[model samples]
Target: MKKEESFSLEKGEANQELDDDGKPTRTGTWLSASAHIITAVVGSGVLSLTWCLAQLGWVVGTSFLVVFAAISWFTCILLTDCYRSHVTGSRNYNYMQAVKTNLGGRKYKLCGIAQYGTLVGVSIGYTITSSISMAAIKRSNCFYKYGHDKECHTLNTPYMLIFAFIEIIMSQIPDFHKLSFISIIATIMSFAYSSIGIGLSIAKIAGGAYPRTSIGLPTRTDISNMDKMWNIFCAIGDMAFAYSFCAVLIEIQDTLKSSPPENKVMKTATTIGISATTSFYMLCGLLGYAAFGNDAPGNYLTGFGYYDPFWLVDIGNLCIVIHLLGAYQVMVQPFFAFVENWSHRKWPESGIVNKDYTVGCFRINSFRLVWRSTYVILATLVAMIFPFFNEFLALIGSMTFWPLTVYFPIEMYISQVKLRRNSFTWIWLKALSFVCLLVSLLAAVGSIRGLVVSVETFKVFRSMS
Candidate 1:
């Protein structure tokens, strides 16, 4: 028995303390859940909101931020209930599991595709975003030394490789349950960078050196109607991306303690998390737009909107790099877990796939190391291939926003509650879902158009200006 226990521990299969559900004892609370959500939600997505506000202008942009936040919170409440099946009254460990338990069959399979696809896309997006921040750090210093007129051009590929190396190491972390510390650190880094961005914007506007402002739509004569329309749609998509954290809602909730009723605790966490996130989003997006007006760069800090106080700019960019390091793991760990768990189940008898070796105090799984490192490498390669920050952000956001954020949650809720067809509640839910679908479709079209334009102008594997 002692030898068997040691083997299990070596294989990283030991769950010494099981909860009433016979799983690892969950000590997560509303606080930790909020941290995880904030870490996931307020990432590179926040950086793009200034550009988003530029496209949509003040009224529409601010309204969209609030609307998206409300929608996310509402659907999140529904999703929280689906954490435990209505019939079985048992836990569904992940988003896919919740869908499978409540709305099984084709819908379950669909949820997997949307959820996992979003995860993979988000990993790539983080790669691109982090690399930009890394390069921005260098570029900011270059301008400070060489004068603003000097072309401080920096290639993003090298920084991307560095970021990938870090992710490759981070990917080895066993699972989501162990990422609370990283999440906490990431949460702080997010606020640090966001606060910095807000402060810089405020300074710029107060200095009275900011660009001309716009109240309604961006009526810039330099751009045509087609360009304006596309920008608006893409802006909506970026907003969608900014407010989205529903894909990981079930996973985060699963980490919470069960005593207070996980659903109740999650709802409260969702309220607090989304509320705080929205407040930050508003300040960052609006203040950034206020500072730069219609000329706001897709990435405000990295776009060199603030040239002086170079050290502070570098610090904010560094914070972004550190934050993304943890954010990448938080977003990608679920995908890693799904793939590894599936492999273990499929090849139960395969020693190479199932075995884990002890490295000092760490348990390193052979299959996990190879598979996860490869995934990070591939994601890095893709990020290098298409590093258009805003366009990629919009594409990923539009693709997953409706399905994972709005559709799956609503469908699962209706199924679990057995709501009658065309009932008042059902009609409104379906209507909201339908409206979001249209928004996503329009945003996707705009994103694809932007990508095409970017590719036409940008040289593949070449340095981004």
Candidate 2:
């Protein structure tokens, strides 16, 4: 059979087909792609998005969300275009493979390292945030009044260790095909949580349970004119930083069975996923800010006072844990592969166990055991020490996310389009590249401003106390 025919046949098998080497073929239906993309995009960002929006009021906040969505959508399209242009024809053209081939040696390695680092930072942030949310739920009046006294409002070291153990075991399961099913359920739960919470908050505002804040044009008190411009710019930057996961998107594309055609399925799925996420962010932000008014909490979802009727806060916590675990698996898998490859390169005749041990748990191989042990220990120490999920997330977003999402994409565009002196049709790509760079820079500044402001505010409160 011709190679093209073999490729087509493999595509027909979708995610189930294995190549001669026993690797699963990347072909997948729209559902699989959508699930992977949505899960990748929706992480701990959903938790604090509302608070960011509240700072600008609902109208402005929603507007900001729309603009951000457009930019993200455009960026994704451009990225897909780049992938199609540079990497589609080759049989081995996956995301990282494409980067290695198109961008060449050092750039690919640097981007890969940055990508891995960002994912690890994000995973740590999510784990810590989820634990805090769980603690908060336990401390709520409902749990304390109704649950077992010993279980309520207690942070038991043993329990945490057990939880960590369970998470690790669950994460080691080899059936990645099942991830799509799990992601679908998680996405549904997220939608339900957002809908119910936003609806209830809106109802309360309408029924006069909470006073509605004026939502017109900005005022001097809202922020100085100079600060308003800065805020708007910063808001855009924050949104970019929050949504930046372009590297992950490349992975999503590579997972498809055939090279993605410019077909309806890909277009429709991408549109729906991006639109829904942006709308969810906007609604959650507006209603949350409106609900809290001037007393709006810094963490939108959790800080919204009163009980969540659907037990959403709890479910949200669980989802965060699950999502983080998945992300951690993806982040670590590459390093594991690299290490195994290195060992095999040195000792070419070793048993498969020596090479495959990195993929699973077993002490016969010291590398697997030592690395996993180190990760767990370091992650635990960080979570225990810093413990402030929001600040940690902000820091990661500023340092790691901005670099990967904005800086890398701009660099990729410049290398692929500008350096090649590509056609005039590529002008918009250049414009977008510039916009991403500008947004990333401004976001770094805003995040620093926010951190400093928080410190100053804390000092004032302490002095007063």
| Residues 242-301, model 2: lDDT tens digits | 565555666555555554462335555667778777778777777776776644554555
Cα lDDT of candidate 1 equals 0.88
Candidate 1's TM-score reads: 0.95
Q: Point to the candidate with the largest lDDT.
A: 1
TM-score of candidate 2 relative to the true fold: 0.77
What are the lDDT scores of the predictions, listed in order? 0.88, 0.56
| Candidate 1 Cα outliers beyond 4 Å, as residue runs | 1-16
Q: For every model shown, what is its TM-score relative to the native structure?
A: 0.95, 0.77
